[model samples]
Target: MPETAVADTATGVPLKELAARHGLASSGRLLGPVEYARQLWGYRHFITAHAKAKTVSTLGTTNLGTLWQVLTPAINALVYYIIFGVIIGTGANTTNFVPYLCIGVFVFGFTQATVSQGVNSITGNLGLIRALHFPRASLPLSAALVEIRNFITAMGVLLIIVLITGEPVNLQWLLILPAMVLQAMFNMGMAMGGARLGSKMRDIKQLIPFIMRFWMYASAVLYPVTRFTDHLHGWKLHLVEANPMLVFVELYRHSLMENVTLAGSPRLLWTEAVIWAVVVCGAGFLYFWRGEKGYGRG
Candidate 1:
């Protein structure tokens, strides 16, 4: 019998002959495990490269650039301690308000960094985005990575404070790792969303600082949420209970404080956190992806 050949529909070439001539018999459309793995590896490499280049470029601008990440948060913590702890007399009620405020500010710093820096991630990288055709998500991811690096540095400062204050470190402290991961996931989503929104509406850039300030006051960073639950009733109480930052702060206090749990309502707060994480992340990713091509233009 003679050998049979299949014709290529688009080019009108014999498929088998083309395959034999070009040594491409096994190089069909990428629909299987090998192709998937190859693409995944390529994406991973691209993301890592983008993150590294961004980190270096961002930190190289100043002589004490990297140190400033740690130093800035430490200074902010001191300011908060002086105003809220020493001057305002809030610390007078708590046994160790220093560590309490330290953790609160440090965690909140992650959120603050995300909102403030994220607004400019797309605009700031307009040159690079227009010049390169890589994934737009990489920009926000790179920014988030830089923020996480700063968070870790601030965390080191927090640990030093914890030790100096004679606080005990235990296995529960490990819980913070997952909490931080969750927090980062939440921030990444928000950053991506913020980047997309800010790119479209420049007014959003101006509003972020005010929003963050209001968020700080509402999140129980300065005072415990419990202080409000005692005075409010019904819907107002529900509003306070539904704040995602309240849950996050409670989680931090629970992990750091000796015996603190979700003070008012554990179930309600956890549900809010889980819902916010899912909804914000999902919506943010979709919003960012939809506008991926537009980011490079303006």
Candidate 2:
């Protein structure tokens, strides 16, 4: 009998009567702040569940699934040690280059895995993307989480190597905690950006491996960044000095092996590294977020 009443076409019931029966106002303000907060909280829970499910599925798919995460990096370190440390003698001059190489390789693996796997992550799961309605960014985030777990396991191996090789432990080792968090954030950002681009272009996926290989060489995983900086002068030296990966590798090496002071006057290189980390990560996240809806369609 009320003027606000409206009939439901399908059920032939009055809309206002139905709302009153259900204890909800049919024409209430659309998604006010309180409702919006509830929606966001639900989204957060869904994302967490999705991420956990993906991680567990990955581990379940293979017999040695998670262990391979640790094994792969350790095996890589051993191979490099044999070739560079024993046979080639490249690491001979540096004190405890074994741990140095191990840490670099271990950390680098995390970055490489996220970048390489993420490039194909969206495209590879195109079927699922079409069938399911979910956050596309979660694919890259899930992949990064898997790599992060692997990195943690590899780090444990690195600590054992450090102790076995008789490297001194100090408060500086705590610095690695922040360093790892920064690196993981940076890698996730890159993965998200790359995944979006790779999904559309497809050609971008092909180029990722070559890009990663070049990055590996540039990052000084096998040797020191000083090798490049010492030889080149002025702007040439500055270019190599500006590499962000080198900064991360150097920070890890300095903190874990050298136990050097992390705080001091910020050098130009350090300042550049900080800037790149922020810029790449911030811009990449925005770039990926903008393309979120597009991913579900294709």
Candidate 3:
């Protein structure tokens, strides 16, 4: 019964090997991708439940409650409309600018919230991290889920705005289903990635708001994509063209508004959407898993 002895009486399997099989032992090393996924799946209920509870508590203090979810983005759209659409005239040249602006705002709102919340996911839930034995990723995954819930609710308002602006409901509107699925996958990845980084560097959380603001502007939330292309050239323009957020925004605008035209071909944008979704989500899941043991301690 030496501490280092490998022998176990009952199974005659080496104690170390038995521990490894059960995942009770390791090289004090990163978990493999498959193993990490298994762990996450085991806690799926915790993730969903936590996300739902957080959503409720988030609105608990407000008199209007969940109504704020839709209102906040609507109010944001109005402010941007006044400044970018009316004052600076960024939306003037665009056809059906209100619908165009609404789609952009609503869609970008999800991405912006996903990343910002992800950055705080781990740090914001330090008490849970310190106290719980479950996967740390549940924190960020739940954060993304909360935003997803908000996005779904806000989308109803977006559809209304598009209809009020005279967008015909067509087969194209169905495209929102796939577009949202892809974007959600991407946000999950981005959120998990941000969660891992934020846990280690708390200062990064403070900078996320400014970063998301710049990202919203760059994603053409309140302005036309033409604003970026008008003065830019070479790969610089292509960089803007291929931005993941821009791809998502264009997808939303195209699906919801007949008057709007996408900057890239639909096929190409769909391909890019699939690529970014898989790449970000797969990579983010793996990255978060790799740091499995370090979260609570660090």
Candidate 4:
């Protein structure tokens, strides 16, 4: 028998053996969580490029392009402020509510868009999933990344709005950074879980918008969470206060606005936010990864 051929390149792996080594797993193989994570890491560049491409392609056909990212949320914040803050008097006791509503709408929309897009990631990319031999998680991760980019752009406008509405820039505002990180993690988890769920039940895509709408209201995006706690008690009050989106909204509001109190204490909210981010992200990733083999099946 011929001696074992050595790989001639610096990586020391031949094109055939290399493929054979990596080809150890078939497409949609059920990888261990750690192995799945490593696989995803190896595809980081693809994830980033795909995410940026998706974000651009989404608005590329339009003249305004990325400006819409900033405008859409601004308009929503204004509409909510007008409808609930003015007509309904939801802003009755809240100070600096223009900025408050702005923060809530922008922050909540971040997670909301992630979940909505996540619900379609795998289904929308069925062609790519079936054709390409990459990690299935990339689709949802890319969607979450798109939302993260959009959120950053939207925040630029949000900060300007906050300043225009007379919220002072203080050390507390620095808290926005950590809160954003946590929320991003939370969004990633939601995206992962939604992708798995949506891929299985295509009808779920249709229902997500309504679910997010309900989530928005429950998050106190348009009104104060106090509305829930002022009368309700027991599990009801806890449920309202414990809503993850509400926690994120309150965190953003606390960091951005002055004289506004959170639904829960700052300490409680921070602790809960961390837990939500870790638990949801970890669970969502594993859940989505576990469904890898099933994503592209007929």
Query: What lDDT does model 3 reach?
Result: 0.88
**Global CA lDDT computed for model 1:** 0.75
The TM-score between candidate 4 and the true structure equals 0.91
Q: Kindly report which residue stretches of model 2 are placed more than 4 angstroms away from their true locations once superposed.
A: 1-42, 259-273
* Highest lDDT scorer: 4
- Scored by CA lDDT, what does every candidate get? 0.75, 0.75, 0.88, 0.90
Point out the higher-scoring one by TM-score: 2 or 4: 4
State TM-scores per candidate. 0.82, 0.80, 0.93, 0.91
Residue 10 C-alpha lDDT in model 2: 93
Residues 1-298 of candidate 3 have per-residue lDDT tens digits of 6666677898888887888788685556666788778878999999999998998898988899999999999998888888888888887789999988888988998988999999899888888887767778889999999999999999999999899888889999999999999999999999999999998998998898898888888887888888777888999988888889999999988888885767688898999999999999999998888887788674
lDDT by residue (108-176, candidate 1, tens digit) is 888888778787888888888878756667777667777887888878877788778867888877767
Mind giving the per-residue lDDT tens digits that candidate 2 earns over 75-194? 999998898778987776677788888888888888998898778778878887888765567677767776787788888988888778878888978878977877887887888898
Error of 3 at 46 (Å): 0.8
Worst 10 residues of 1 by lDDT: 27-36
- In model 1, the Cα lDDT at residue 96 comes to 75
Counted clashes in each candidate structure: 0, 0, 0, 0
Off by over 4 Å in 3: 1-5, 9-13, 17-29
Q: Clashing residue pairs, candidate 3?
A: none
Clashing pairs for predicted structure model 1, backbone only: none
